[model samples]
Target chain A: AQSVSQHNHHVILSEAASLELGCNYSYGGTVNLFWYVQYPGQHLQLLLKYFSGDPLVKGIKGFEAEFIKSKFSFNLRKPSVQWSDTAEYFCAVNRRTGFQKLVFGTGTRLLVSP
Target chain B: GAGVSQSPRYKVAKRGQDVALRCDPISGHVSLFWYQQALGQGPEFLTYFQNEAQLDKSGLPSDRFFAERPEGSVSTLKIQRTQQEDSAVYLCASSLDGGVSQPQHFGDGTRLSIL
Candidate 1:
């Protein structure tokens, strides 16, 4: 079975601090990676996705993620974070050839303090 | 609709009661999905539909959970004799197709609470 692991459960950072949320998956095949963000009382929104080609992908709201194939990791990062950036982040993976059933990781809750 | 829409944003039901959750996908979307998100956890796939056909339902926890996209555009997830463990936020997502590259559009989920 495929599973995603998010190393952080909770993170606290001051405004302007850099953010890095680690995500690792246990799949050996070609996979599609995604990062989703859920704001307080809001629906989950896609932050970015990686299919093929360049390993680095930029997403909305100045967010970006690097799909390191060797490490089996797709970590999300932002140079600076604001209080508005506080939200729950989820990492999801699915095989590139199947019905695209997403397997999501336990989410990381980030609190950006002003 | 501009985006995927789910009804009864909040639902509170007593144990052993049956509850039905509705999802309306974007117009012309060929794929629809249902997911369950427990408190403080990521969403988990429950079922998938392509048009009016349910292509995959392997993620459904048990026989108590049933879903139907009779016409393909509107879907319903029915939980029979709901238990406490059934409490979670049920989310609906849709994509242009079941293709791997298509990004899914999500709706504000229906938060189900079993009392």
Candidate 2:
């Protein structure tokens, strides 16, 4: 079975601090990678996605993720995070060839304290 | 208002009761999917449909859970004889096409609490 692993379960940082959440998947095929963010009371929103082409993909809200195929990693990163950026982030993936269901990793809860 | 919508933002039911959750995908979305998110966890795939055709249901936990998109638009997920373990947030997502490249947009999930 395909699985995703998120190395961090909780992270705390002061405002303006850098952010990096690690994500790795165990699938040996062409995969579509995504990062979704959920505010305290909001639905999951697409942050970034990588299908093909450039491995570096930029997303909304100053978020970007790099897909390192050799490492099987698609880590989310932000140069500087604001208090409002605190939320649960999820990394998901699916096979790139078909209409496949997304396999998500255990979310990482980040708290940005001002 | 063009995003996917889910009805009954919250629901509470007895252990043995039956419950239904509805999902209204974005207009003209050909692929609809259902997912279950436990507390403090990521959303897990439950099932998906490609224009009223059930393509994959392998993610469903058990036979008690059933989902349908009869008109290739609105979808419903029904759970019979619900158990306490069924408590979770049921999320619905839709994409313009069933192809692999399209990004799925999600709806505010229906939080189900079984007592």
Candidate 3:
């Protein structure tokens, strides 16, 4: 079955720390990738998406992700994270077939301590 | 009105009772979807609708689950004889079309607890 995976289940970092959250999908076809964030008591929000072209996609609040086709990965990154950046991050993928429904990974919870 | 909205942000129901969850997609969006999120797990697709047409119900886990999008707009997901395992957050999302690249706008979701 098609599925997305996140390597980290939980992560902790101090303020201004560099961040990298890994994501990989198991599909052998063209796909669309996305990163979503959910803060405490808030709904999921789109942080960024990559459809095609430029593999390095930048999104809201200084977050970015790179789509590496060969590795079937779209890892999210941020040079520096703030305490406000603490949240649960999810990686999702839509195979280029059927109705294009998304398959999401089990999210990664990030805690940024001051 | 500006984004997807779900009704009854939280619900508590006894096992075997029927429950209906509502979803109002963004205006002009042609695609609507339903997903179930268990604790500590990703949201799993339940169903999809294009306008008033039900394009895909493959993701639905059992016959007890039903969803409809009447008038090509508002949608509802009804679960019959809810089970304890049915307790989860039900999310509704909408997009411009069922295209491969359209981004889905999600609602806050309704957290359901089946006792």
Candidate 4:
């Protein structure tokens, strides 16, 4: 069975601080990676996705992620964070075959204090 | 509609009762999916439907959990003999195509509470 693991459970940072959320998955085959964000009382929204091609993928709201095949990791990063970026972030993985079902990791709660 | 819509923004059901949650996907969406989100956790896939056919239902926890997209447009998730553990937000999402590259649009979801 495929599973996603998010190393950080909660992260607290001041405004303008650098952000990095670690995500690793347990799958040997081709996979699709995604990062989704859920604001307070809002629905889940896609932040970025990596299907094929470049390992570095840029997403909305100045967010980006790097897919490292060697490490089996797709880590979410932001050069500088804002207070508005406070939300729960989830990392998901979908296998290339076998139904393409998305397996989600336990979310990471980010609190950006101004 | 601009985005996916779910009905009964909030639902409170007694234990052992039955509840039906509705999801209205965006117009012309070819794929629909249902997910269950517990508090402080990521959304878990429940099922997926392509058009009127249910392509995948392996995520459903048990036989008590049922979902249908009769016309391939509107979908419903029905829980029979609901338990306290069944209390969670039910989310619906739709995509333009069922392909791997297309992103999914999610609804605000129906928060179900079993009291």
Ranking by lDDT: 1, 2, 3, 4
In candidate 3, the residue pairs with backbone N, CA or C atoms under 3 Å apart (3 or more residues apart, or in different chains) clash, namely none
Q: What does the lDDT read for residue A114 in candidate 2?
A: 99
Model 2 regions lying over 4 Å from their true place: none
Error of 3 at B87 (Å): 0.2
Candidate 3, residues A37-97: lDDT per residue as tens digits? 9999888888999988999999999999999999999999999999999999999998776
Clashes of 1: 0
Candidate 3: lDDT of A91?
A: 99
> Where is model 4 more than 4 Å wrong at Cα?
A98-100
Complex DockQ per candidate = 0.85, 0.84, 0.81, 0.65
Model 3 TM-score, 2 decimals = 0.98
Residue pairs that clash (backbone atoms under 3 angstroms), model 2: none
lDDT of 2 by residue, B1-115 (tens): 6789999999999999999999999999999999999987899999999999999998899999999999999999999999999999999999999888888999999999999
- TM-score comparison, 3 vs 4, better candidate: 3
Clashing pairs in 1: none
Give the DockQ-based CAPRI class for model 3. Answer: high
Summed backbone clashes in each candidate are 0, 0, 0, 0
* lDDT to native, each model: 0.95, 0.95, 0.94, 0.93
Error of 4 at A4 (Å): 0.5
lDDT over C-alpha atoms for residue A80 of model 4 = 99
TM-score of chain B of each: 0.98, 0.98, 0.98, 0.98
